[model samples]
Target chain A: MKDTALLSAPLQVQDLTVSYGGDPVLTGADLTVPEGEMTAIIGPNGAGKSTLLKSALGLVKPLSGTITAWDQPLAAQRDRIAYVPQRASVDWDFPTTVLEVALMGLYRQLGLLRRTRPHHRDKALACLDRVGMSDLADRQIGQLSGGQQQRVFLARALAQEAELYLLDEPFAGVDAATEAAIITVLHGLRDAGKTVLCVHHDLSTVPRYFDHVCLLNRHTVAQGPTATTFTDANLMRTYDGRLPTAA
Target chain B: MSEFIALSLPPMLIGTLAAMACALPGNFLLLRRQSLIGDAISHTVLPGIVVAFLLTGSLAALPMMLGAAAAALLAVVLIELIRRFGRVEPGAAMGVVFTTMFAAGVLLLEQTDTASVHLDVEHALYGNLESLIWLDGFVPGALTDPQALATLPPELTRMALTLAVIALALWIFWRPLALATFDNGFAQSLGLPVTTLSLGLVVCAAMAAVAAFDAVGSIIVIAMFICPPASARLMTNDLKHQIAWSLAFAALSATLGYVLAGYGPLWLGAEASVSAAGMIATVSGLILGGTALAGPHRKA
Candidate 1:
């Protein structure tokens, strides 16, 4: 039974419900993300898309839910998980350099007296290189363009060296070139047997970018291989009987 | 020379140490957009101290600190509860909590027959800085003399130790603190104890405020906590450089403000020296104003 739990999925959520003083943002949201695949969670505006991800990361308190990664609580396996929050979630003008943001990914390794040794710096630099942000390592994060800023965050996540990566809107407001760069990196992560889940929009790019889709509004509308489940019917069902004009 | 060592040096040292202690945590607070927390914590200290004095019937430091820490913790918890349950914004929640506590303190002072003791609102606002005189400083070669060092004002030793403790805390928790302050969700995802770390930061700020409350007074600690770090934010894009700039700015403000308050009136042909704590806060404000005008990152 334990072996089945471990081998079945990288992430699973059951009976997840969330609300904030008003109405339910998400209700009975169940999801299962397969291991070593890139999955996109698509939904329309105010659809609890971000809430689902937040709940899974334990960033938000769900009304009724259970979440597990590798058959264990997320808290138990947090060291193997990396999360990239939305770009709009933080102040870009904060006093920090690109290299410093990348090094933040490695903070879990350092104990109380957080002294970044040479190897840590080397690791951070290498992660920046992975995201093609090595040249801008010394620059402040506020100085970067929107796309460059996203890349820097991606670099920070790469520094974590985790078994699973969860990104919220990795392609939002990014230039085409940066979008390409990000997808390539996501693909690399998948090829390396790392589970990748992204809260995504842009239905036009859904089938192109992701191998699987979890169509959601307040609850899971559809889930499976993109070719089979990411159909016009599922998109309409998830988006409330009306397909959004290509955004 | 002897006169300088006996009267001026101790107050100046106390002021500098106090300023440094507050300014260290001020950097993170300013960056986190929670600068008014310093104001809130310092204001709440009055009620805490008053309660402590009422309980112990004494002016000992430990009881005062314990009471202040407890009050600060309560204030923070209250602010959070109001923010979360009451749906009030964080700033508004803080404003309500701290001001109410401070008013309660004033009422307590009025209600109690504490005039016999040296506890007064005036003393809490503008601490008696000139009284931190070091009799040991009058000894020749006092810098090297162990006996003279032992005779230094307790306020000076305590302020210096406060500064050291705050600096060490900043250094040790540098990573988690920066991570949590910058992006709370990301830090939590990385398994950082975000709640504990933030509470620890507030504890550090409150500790500095309580310690400096005696020497620099309860009010001016806000300026030291704000102005230096705000100016440093304007000056630098790197947290490390910003911290260095704030420490330098803090020391400079303390020294320059002390000298100006002590001698500027004399140079302008006045009789009495003005308030050193007031002058220090004013100097820091002037520095902040200057940086805001011409700082490289001012636009940001």
Candidate 2:
């Protein structure tokens, strides 16, 4: 199964286990994210949905498991992966402009001490434009609304120009227009053959937004194309009766 | 001319250079919310200086700086250990480590007879800038004399070199430093060696403190480390602009405070000037307080 996953998927996690302090948050979880598809990982709160993504990104250590991205270790392929943490994780009042935050995505390429070249600035502006944040490029991050903040984060990720994107709760607390803008950008990434993994909470937009679904509750309950895996039974297992209505 | 230069100019130049050096890295420390580390390192270095003097039996510059740097690094390491093993907040860990180290330093000082040596505990805590005079005896026409320039105290030269090095380090590592300070996780994901970058910053802060502490005392060094950068932060949202503003504020406070210390006492009919280091710290605090109240970017 491991060999088959390596051949078919861009990302594969096998028998992954993780814990915080003493209790395990994830146990023997197996997942494979298909290439060039927008995959949504849906689960109840405290079900380790974000942990799964963090483990894959090497931000969190797993107790016992293997995660392979692009047929290699995550560390070796770090440049190809872009992560957008939950907006609430950052201090919005920090003294930085939107352009400066977006420019951070190019630090890897720019290296140490070197100024951001003209073309890099152009690329950053283009990314901001892609996310519809061009006009607010000079605004302080704290001054932006929740939706605008989310868009700026998307713009920063776009500046990375990575092959795979991992976004933690991108739509949480965002307005409708920002949600639509994010969805458009996700679709654009998918259409361009880039992969995206989002930790999504709202059950109503699962089918409309995602091409693949990974229903998780400390372990993988179901994983496959959205049509077959996003069943009411799998969601019940993932959400553990907290899911209000049957789909 | 010689009298003015000998009496007032050296301390002003020394204060400005020392404050600039401390404020440069203080900007990043403030951004990272580790401003107390400056205070911690400054206090802990006292023990290192005492131990180095005991070991070397001399008041040489290099030995004292090395001792101070070692002590600062040790303080950081201890703080980390306590925070990790003792599971306390970083501020509390720093408070415990620095206060203990400072007490040890004071105890060591009490055990030694330092009257014969130039090392005075009171002078160390509150610098004696008024005593830093040219060794050439301030003859007439001494301002243009090469021999007089050579006789200038080494403290001024040391501070000048420190300022140059601090500026160079900030310029050379601006990108990685900014990225790591702003977002450590993202910087690490980009394979930027965030841990090493953070350690380098702490080491730089330690070195700056060592270079300035002898002439300005830990009080002024601590104030400069937090005040100028923090005031600059309240005035600008851009990092580059913030650095520039911080340097400006540091220079302003040093010059203005020196003037106030020297002349303000005379205006009030006092016979002599007060402590230059203390006055500089007081002025920096006033500037910060004023900026916090009236700066354009003051938080609502």
Candidate 3:
């Protein structure tokens, strides 16, 4: 058949449904994120893009169906996945420094009751160095600008060292140089055979940035190679009922 | 004035130290939005103490404190389960779990028939530092003389030891606590066990609550748990600075409150019934509120 067995998908979400209290944000959404590639999920506001990523990370519980990663269930294999939330979702004013936040990725490995050893601290600094945030390691998170905050989170995800990386809107409020830096980091991860799935908002950069794409509006409109799948028709369906081809 | 000083100064010192210990953990709890869990555990520990008392019929601090910590830890696990599996909101889950546990504790007290043991809900809520002063001293061994010399207040010693243990715990887990409180998801991916850290925090908090129960009483411990850290948060966005400032404020408030409660009655033309514990709480609240209102929007 197509060696589907050997080429196992890193993340497989089947008929996933989620809601806030009662209103359904995603109904029967299905997606598969492959290993060793950069996949971008793009849509307009309220398109359930973030919801899709949240479900995958177990941040939001699915009402039905299941999600699997690397042939194992996502529930039992939490350490194997890393999530980078939207820049605005957290309180920057929280009394923590950049290095401290970056070290959070080491929490799972170090255990809650354990201290971050000199080695772990050194590793966190290394991730920061990769993201060019090593100089700002001791800066209070609240004092950082939006772009710096975004970079800090990326470094945190890097510190996680997970096989599967899920990031949401990392580029929304960042500068172009930071965006380029983030893209470079993601490209490096992809080249190293790690899977990266990012919920992105920039339509113009999709062609240049991502290797794969998932177009979604409640249900997944399309999923495949960016060149073959991000067609005018799919973009129109993702945006709304209005067709870009007819226009 | 000297008599009042002798009666209250020692307890006030112990209470201030206890409050400082509580504030260290409280800073993280407040940021994580788990401040009310302290109030919950403080109340729920009553039944545990009562049970331990009924079993021994002797007032021993160690066993009773262990029993209280165990009970509070159970309450925390239950809250986590309900929040995770039941898909309940955090606030609602906390309210339900704490209230349920508190009610169970009350029922346990009635069943144990130790209502008149004087560790009732009121005393548990509104502590009497006066009582702790008498808890000071060493019991002579059987081989020693029948008439023994008295020692310094054991309450002070216990407070000192408790604070040392708490300080050590914070020092070890400082980074993880900071990370988990700010971003749990990232912490988890990094392989940090946010749950274990949370459990450790609650256990430490429970231990502190039990340690201070004698000096600060259970009720006013909330002031210690929340006030200093809340006030410190207003002044700085740095975690280290918050810990330092909160400790300083806690020590200052305790001294000020102790001095005021002892001497303010002469100026007011009436005997002051307000305890140093209450005065410190009021002062901490005022500082917290003032700072929150006037503090810069830069941090937020």
Top TM-score: which candidate number?
Answer: 1
Best by lDDT: 1
True contacts kept of each: 0.86, 0.59, 0.64
Off by over 4 Å in 2: A1-8, A19-22, A244-247, B76-90, B137-145
Worst lDDT run of 10 residues, candidate 3 chain B, spans: B134-143
Alpha-carbon lDDT, every model: 0.89, 0.86, 0.78
Query: Over the true interface residues, superposed, what is the Cα RMSD of model 2?
Result: 1.5
Write model 1 residue lDDT over B1-300, tens digit each, in one string: 988998999999998989999999999899888888899889998889989999999877899899998888888799999999999898899889999998888888778878775577776787778788888788889878998888888888888888899999888888788889999999989778899988888888988998888677876799998999999999989888999999999999999999999999999999998998889999999999999999999864
Task: Give the interface RMSD of each candidate.
Answer: 1.1, 1.5, 3.2
How does each model score on TM-score? 0.94, 0.93, 0.77
How would you encode candidate 1's per-residue C-alpha lDDT over A1-247 as one tens digit per residue? 1336435587898889999868999999988888999999999999999999999999998989899988889999888999999998999999889999998888778756757899999999999998889999999899899999999899999988998899999999999999999999999999999999999989888888899889899998988889999887788788888787643
- DockQ for all models, in order? 0.80, 0.64, 0.41
User: Which CAPRI category fits model 2?
Assistant: medium
True-structure lDDT of candidate 3: 0.78
Candidate 2 per-residue lDDT over residues B1-300, each given as its tens digit: 667787678878888998999999999999898998788888899999888999998767789888987887788799999999999998799889999998888788888987776566776676666666675636777768888888887889998998898889888988888877877767766777777888888778887888887788788889999999999988987788999999999999998888898889999999998887888889999999989998888777
lDDT (0-100) at residue B117 of candidate 1?
Answer: 58
i-RMS of candidate 3: 3.2
